[model samples]
Target chain A: MDISAFVLFWAAIFTSNILLTNFLGMCSYLSVSREVESSFGLGVAVVFVLTITAALNWLVYHYILVYFGIVYLQFIVFIIVIAAFVQLLELIIERYTPALYYTLGIFLPLITVNCAIFGVSLFLVIRNYNFLQSIAFGAGSGIGWLLAILMLAAIRRKLKEKMVPLGLQGVGISLIITGIMALAFVGFSGIVQIQ
Target chain B: MFTIIIKDVTVLSAIGSLLAIIMVIAQRRLSNYGDCKIDINGKRELVIKGGNSLLSSLSDKQIFLPSACGGRGSCAACKCKVISGGGPILPTEKPLLTKAELAAGDIRLACQVKVKSDIKIEIPAGIFNIRRFNATVTEIIDYTYDTKGITFKFADGEKIDFLAGQYVQLETKPYGKVKQGVIRAYSISSKPEINSSLQLIIRYVPEGICTTWVHQHLKLGDTVSLTGPYGDFFLRDTDADIIYVAGGSGKAPIKSMLEHLAVIGCKRKMTYFFGARTTKDLYLTDEMHAFEKVFPSFEYVPVLSHSEQGDGWTGKTGFVMPYFKDAIRDPKNTEAYLCGSPGMINAVTKALIEEGIPKDKIYYDSFG
Candidate 1:
């Protein structure tokens, strides 16, 4: 909480991205980054889940866990909160907004156990971010993830027309691009370093 | 120390219970669509709890639609016309549907359509006639080393009125560690006229669940459940000359159709090309010969692929493709009905197409 909320926000997006810098959530990152449309769907879902769960976990950790002096139960409790919130959200959206339920709600289940969502909550605690700073970091990290996947998906879509060598196709090329993206993001470390 | 353990346990349980309670209440408030009315083809109305997919909702009423992938929405076989209350098609179903179907604005996959409210849909009229029946195994005759013909008599003297070439979903009890029973489609080998009982020729497919149960576990008088008369590989009303080609257990629907044709005194000239690996793989030779005697215009041509040096085999040899010319008097006037493996069906379709039979005229029920 010592550093400004604006600084932490920019730092999460540029210098210490949850996906590029820490590499917490790679499963959905690699698989869903094949098409821009689906990758967009998954990225938005991840962002939505990550930001909400981060705030929810912070509240639960501070209000419940700290109040009860059972901080050891943070892991299980955080997971349950994230999963239950996503399920409840999906049901509610499917009932009220059928269109959004089909498009965005379809991707919510994939984010239930996503380490990236959990990683943001942990980062908020580890860095001792206050309420506003935690929200900024959560949102910035989500934007950073969204940026990474959209880039990968767009490049992959272009690569579909080009001929890559037989062995280094699909996941092979995606990883190389991700590594290059990570290296490029390293250049932004000189501007602001969060971790 | 005792109080610390109690505190930790109570906190954890409280958090978990609170979240569970919220989710349960949210689910009830949001997802309770209540009873919905499904008006199908304007002929039938079904009242059901309107939360499940249209496929399961209709299936709950014993009206089984043909779905190759069950209800995963993979196979578009469960497509039905939704006149109204069918919402806009989702992205998942858009790729599987054709441009024409999409433009029609009514065709929707039953498995994909959730029963949210009152929906009006039009399905094949035949789907209305499908029924669930309990039947008992009355006979099991060895058709080949790997194939057996089993007769099942419907319990309670119930009769299943199926088309000549239609198939039934034979359900098998859960044996061994398999917790739930499974259903597999098998063509009705008995004549459709004989509605009280029907028979199926099931060939042992190494690890096939239904085949294994039918061949090894099922005994005479063992009761089995089944749903009926699904599939469209039946004989058309055309009087065009017929060409029936079947291999292995593909002979079931053909047998049903032939018996039906004979019973109805069909006057269409018929030529059946039966393909097999060897003499042992061939079955129903006597029955086919008996058909030759009873039906004046019917002809049988059995082809052996793996005939040995001295197997006493004297018939049209090799694949059935080359014998199309010999079997047909006029290819243009002939309609071919093929039942076999995918490979066999592809080859037969190609051969028939090359023999000048139009693609539309060649009806087939390839093995799934």
Candidate 2:
């Protein structure tokens, strides 16, 4: 629980991946991974949102929930904070950066209920990570999620025309590929372990 | 225990309310596009407060665009060309547009296109004629076993100016488990000449959202919102003999046309082939018979598709297509206007084409 922020960052990306390892944000991961372009956009948005919300939620948890001994309310409070941040980020991105908004704006609303954001917050709370460590873990898990989705999207792009078994087409095939990838990431477990 | 429960509820609600307040403030401040100019077809201009979808914004300005799903991006019906300033199409709109449509550029679903910036858009010119009308349900009559005719009277002396065959999008409020209101297009059955009231023939389709709501939950004198006088299925002004074919509640618009023709005292030879299962499936038979007496050249033929032997059936038995040859004297110059289910429309259209009627001469509205 007292792991270095740098180690937690690396560990989150490889071993305790919010997506691949924990399987927390599977809905958007499966759905939006059909195209590399959209997957990249959503991945970047996730990386940005996860880092911000993790820090914000950590502050809210320590300063507010823990102060009241109502840490049990972390789930609802964390979801609310994530949703509120995503909403605010979407509005800012859309208004100022029109080009970035075109790519990332559409994905912001989808990311609100993406359990990965909530998952990272919960992971930080459960693991007792301070603000800096929480942010590192959030960013790393986001990048890990990004890497996983991008790889799947590339494979899916190639498999677009390639005939797979009828029963394992579309999402079925993607999930099977994800399982194999998760096994491959298991190879990185020796490099670092935080959970 | 009491204090802890109160504390838990209070904390959760406080956090929720705080976030809600922040979101509201952020939405207003960040999303305020400030008096955005909507250059519609480069012909008309409107300055309105921005931050709503293009469809709703236009509708707010009394310039109704055809959207069946209200502002939801699900229905791909509300499509317009954003010539400039409505940035790249969002992910929600991508699934609905076709590959060729995407390649052609600028064709965006109006419901998905948020008005965050001043944008010029091109819509069908016919869209201008459609208007949002406020009306109240005046009468609900059981026309048959499953079908009911609901007459909606225009509120506040306001009148609906629509063609006989054109239809309106009926808006239903959220009732029971239906969380949001649904928009359904039903043909205007009442005579357009009346203007003050419009009637729609709604058949109960079991679990159908709109029809079930209309049948069970809808009551007399209830207020309703309607967008209308839309569709290209109106009567064409030509000298060609008319062949009217319809079935089930499909008979609604055809009856409107017949009534309009009756009011105008149309002289062209007309024959109506109304198909049904049996006597129980039929409604407004007496009205059609009355039309036969009024018009000098009009003929009424009701074909019972599933008429049983010795069921007190005296009218034409069998499908409508078999009786088409006997109904008409001129096939080449006949303009057939059909309304019904897609199956019925396709079958009747094929039969008409085979009977020597030109393909372009046939008109129908297969409502989704």
Candidate 3:
């Protein structure tokens, strides 16, 4: 019996949410999720970069790493693929859609180091996902990260006006909220098995 | 082990070569730019390759415009009016342009606008004169605990002709732990008569990118790049009694103008009021006093805001502006030259205006 693409996709998004459950990309999530508007912008940017890089990394891994039998070099290969893809994407975006590029600004460079992108690629390869399954899982993981950040950003904006305790004013309170959200997401773990 | 290593290297090199070849082919076949021409202010025309942005295109032809961010489009400093041959205005340019700017023909960020076709752009006349200079650090002298006076001698150019208070941009190359070169603006501290070299009075701003490079990384003998003579702060040509007020590193341009007056033998009556928090902040008292002797009508007034215990300060007390208000016999006829932090400039300007000096007669260069 084989796990279907749809099952893996939903499982990766909810039960094994990369941000809340595993906490893979907490740095940018916390820093950029301060404002709802900026968070939405960053979220969309992450989704776009993650989906494209995942597919590109898959191609590189299968064609280059596997062909050379240097599977140990997967990490380096994935990083280089992600960086080059981001640079090419930046040039294309500047030429075709200048507006989106401006809004991304310095954040575009930040996307290259984003952990969620590498996480998605690594998981797809480890799970031996077929091309269709990899695409579905990659896009689903990005959507999951997007949804989690949007919720966190809205909560953070509301908490700005409210009295926050001295010790938990910034990242401390955000981490606590993330822990609670992870437990809530655990409710969906029984619905599907990812690995 | 050597065999495995050789195989790994061979594979990597093969992949690199393949990518390079593909890139070259794509660049040549896919990215070919056709003939393009650019018209400047309905006065001149330039013909060049068509694909690159207007900023780099203009720069290639030696038409320099002020772009502090190096055509990254992040600064929005390189804006030009594209009256014709400009395609749709880009979204990147919208944030920098006002509604009035957009309505008046076509205004575009030069870095963002591609030269897909021949274009006409309206550029300021002053931008035509902006030039890059190769200079060497001739001298570096400490003025205060945190301030240093740096002088750069032009390698080839005999003189840099500039207004008394205008600033020049210094390009600091990446050294030691730094990564990339960056451009930072500083007011020219040297008198205009000595045109072969440029001097700047820099105050250390802790952890500031450009200042840190200048203070820690720059050496006395190394060469550096500079472009300049920007800004509109200068002494107005008038016979009225002059009031010059400055603080901290803001002393640069004011010192230049005062030295300029002595060099030109101008006999206008001038009172220079220098404000400092303490005695340690005061510098060049003897030099200023010498200027007063040279020009019999000039006076140097150093005001201390917070006097020390054993400093034995015997000068005007309190802020510099209030002292000017009490001492000036006729405020209405005085032309003021001010350079300082934005807060100090605002306070002094407000006080001078209240004292019957016309706003037009008062010129200021503020570092915000």
Candidate 4:
């Protein structure tokens, strides 16, 4: 249970990666990963939302759910906390970061229901991660998802010019590419043992 | 066990309420964009609270922009020149703007642009004249099985000055199962001389919010709210030969133009072609015939595309394009006015272009 922050960070990205290994948040990973610019924007938004929601949910879980011994209600409680936190972050970003607001603004709403953020919070609670470990896990998982999507997007952009087969053009080819990337990511499994 | 359930409910509710209160406070503090000053054409300045869209802001100032989708950004009709301080064009606006317009850095969709700061925008001078009026439904005439010609008299003894072919937005109150009021643009079917009274011909669209309300729930002697005289679809002041093509409720603005011509006693040669699916689908035939009788220069031709033998229809049959191709003899000196669904208008516009009518000479209003 005494997981180091350094090991948790690397393990979340590589060994137990949120997208490539765990296969969570594949919907946006497949759809938004078609273009590099849009993929970049969505990746940054996911990372930002995931890290903050993870820390916020950790506090909520300990101070409220665990304090009252209502740990069974963590799922619904965590979701509500994540959604409200994302909304607040959106309003603040829209006010301050006008540049990033234009690029990543539209995808802010999409990040609320992103199962990857929920997965991070749930995993942090289940694994009994301390505050630092939870934050590291959250940021690492988000960066892992971002990296996977960016790689796939770059390959897809290249694949656009090359002639794909008749049957495997759009989503068919993209899914195949993702599968191959997932297999490649399995090579990083034993680098850092999370459990 | 029962006491444990109560405690669980109490704790969850407490957490939920705490989050809700926090959200309320954050929304109030963060979403407030403060009061913004909008410079209109370098002549007028409007200072208003600025958390909403530029379209709604302009509307609050009584400067109405023509938006068929009512600021939903689907219509793209509420576009204006954002001269400065409007910030970058949004992703919602990119698809609606042309490459040239985007590069020019002046045009933007008013509905998508938030007024977060002081901005300078240029709108058409005519938008200032649009005024909201309270009116009472004096009569509703069934023009077809699905269409009604509803006439509204100004609740105040005020006359509206408008062009021959323009539209007004009719605001519907919530009725029946519907809970929200909506505004729909309907063309004025009568000429400007009608003055204190305005008539709109509306076709019932299946399950449409405003149309269903108008057809099923609206009663005569009921008071309604309306805003005036929007659109560029109108008769040009020229002596050129006129060719008018219309179908269904598209006949509204065209009828207004023809009546205005008749009232002015203009002697230009005019050919009016009205298309319908069958004889039963046609209305105002007697009135059009009467206009032809009084104005020797005008001719009325009703075309039915789906007429049956029992109907005994003796008129040009098939789509209006063929009849238009045959009737348009002097395309060089002819101006064609078209109002219809997008399909019909596109066909007619194509035919007009093929027949040598200048693109600028072809005026049309196509309902999406």
Task: Give a tens-digit lDDT track for model 3, residues B149-249.
Answer: 99999997756888788888888888777788887778998898898998999988997778888888777987998887777688778788899999888
- Per residue, candidate 4 scores C-alpha lDDT tens digits across B61-130 of 8888888788887889888999998887776688899999999978999988889889999988888888
Better of 2 and 4 by TM-score: 4
The candidates, ranked best first by DockQ, are 1, 4, 2, 3
Tens-digit lDDT string for candidate 4 (A43-71): 98888888988999999899988899999
What is the interface RMSD, in angstroms, for predicted model 4? 2.2
Query: Chain B TM-score for each model?
Result: 0.94, 0.85, 0.82, 0.93
Q: For model 4, what is the alpha-carbon lDDT of residue A67? A: 91
State fnat for each of the candidate structures: 0.74, 0.65, 0.29, 0.55
Listed in order, the DockQ scores are 0.72, 0.45, 0.28, 0.53
RMSD of each: 2.2, 5.0, 5.5, 3.4
Tell me the docking grade of candidate 1: medium
**Superposed model 2: Cα runs more than 4 Å off:** A1-18, A34-37, A53-84, A93-138, A154-173, A187-195, B1-25, B98-104, B122-129, B132-140, B173-181, B216-224, B265-269, B289-298, B314-332, B350-358
Candidate 1 global lDDT: 0.87
iRMSD (1 decimal) for each model: 1.4, 3.5, 3.1, 2.2
Chain B global fold similarity (TM-score) for predicted model 4 against the true chain B: 0.93
1 or 2, greater by lDDT: 2
lDDT score for residue A99 of model 1? 57
Tens-digit lDDT track of model 1 for B1-368: 99999989988998899999999899888889999999988988999998899988999988888776667778687888999987888776888899999999888888888899999998888887889989999999998999999999999989898888888888889887667677678889999999999999999999888888888899998999888788889999997899999999989999999999888888789999999999889899988978888887888888999988888888878988998887777888899999999999999999898889889999999885
List residue ranges in candidate 1 displaced over 4 A: A96-109, A161-169, B91-95
